[model samples]
Target: MTLQLEDEQAQKLPFDYEELAKQVIDQVLGMEECPYESEVSLTLTDNTKIRQLNREFRKIDKPTDVLSFPLVDFQKPADYDLLESDGWEVYFNPESGELMLGDIVISIERASEQAREYGHSLKREYAFLIAHSMLHLLGYDHMISEEAAVMEQKQAAVLKKLNITREGE
Candidate 1:
């Protein structure tokens, strides 16, 4: 997998964000049984930039913790077969031969705030957000109650597997 990560935030966290993000992304894909090599881009920024993006794309004037932009429309979430069948040239990166999963944008400020609010470490919060966004990139959404529950379960599972607990363990 190729992770193109761009860190544009001024405030640096205590932990290695890139390493954690890669672990979470890889774990999510593994759990979902994605059969192909994948490509994902992640952007770490502050609330100001994320707010602008949120307003422009989602028409929501407020800043969100994270945003996901998925490239493929899967018949089922993490259905690699469907992705492979629907013209591989469109979904696969020409040079890397990796499936272009999607993009993730995270607000470092919002993540820290949420971690404090939830009484968790920043590492756990970041992992949670990345897992959530990775799910979105794989075509999973929480727009409905059932879907939300499933997403929550999956996110928790991913974090637990990585040993990223609420206590930052």
Candidate 2:
């Protein structure tokens, strides 16, 4: 898996945010058993920029912690066979040949605030957001109760596996 990460925040976080993103993304892909090599883009921005993105993409005029834009539409979550059957050549990068999974935009400012409000480390909050967005990229949604429960379980599992618990530093 290849993660193309960019930080656009004015004040960068003290921790190694890139490494944490990569770890969470890799763990999500592994857990989902994605067959093909994948590529994902992540941008770390501030509340103002993220709010603009949210307004443009989702028509919501508020800042959100993270936004996911999935490139491939999966019939079933994490089902690679469907991609092969459907012949989704449009979802692959010609040069890299990696499946272009999706793009993720995160608000560093919101994440920090949420971490403090939730009584967790900033690292843990970032991991949770990334994991949550990864699940969305892989065709998962939390619109309904059952789906939300599944997504919550997966996010918790990913953070736990990485030792990025709420109480951990």
Summed backbone clashes in each candidate are 0, 0
Q: Please, what is the TM-score per model?
A: 0.97, 0.97
Q: Which residue runs of candidate 1 sit more than 4 Å off their true CA positions? A: none
lDDT of 1 by residue, 66-89 (tens): 999999887778877776563757
- Score residue 153 of candidate 1 by CA lDDT: 97
Off by over 4 Å in 2: none
Q: Alpha-carbon error at 37 in model 2, in Å? A: 0.9
Q: Which window of 10 residues has the lowest lDDT sum in candidate 1? A: 79-88
Candidate 1 to native Cα RMSD, angstroms = 1.0
Candidate number of the best lDDT: 2
In candidate 1, residue 99 scores what lDDT?
90
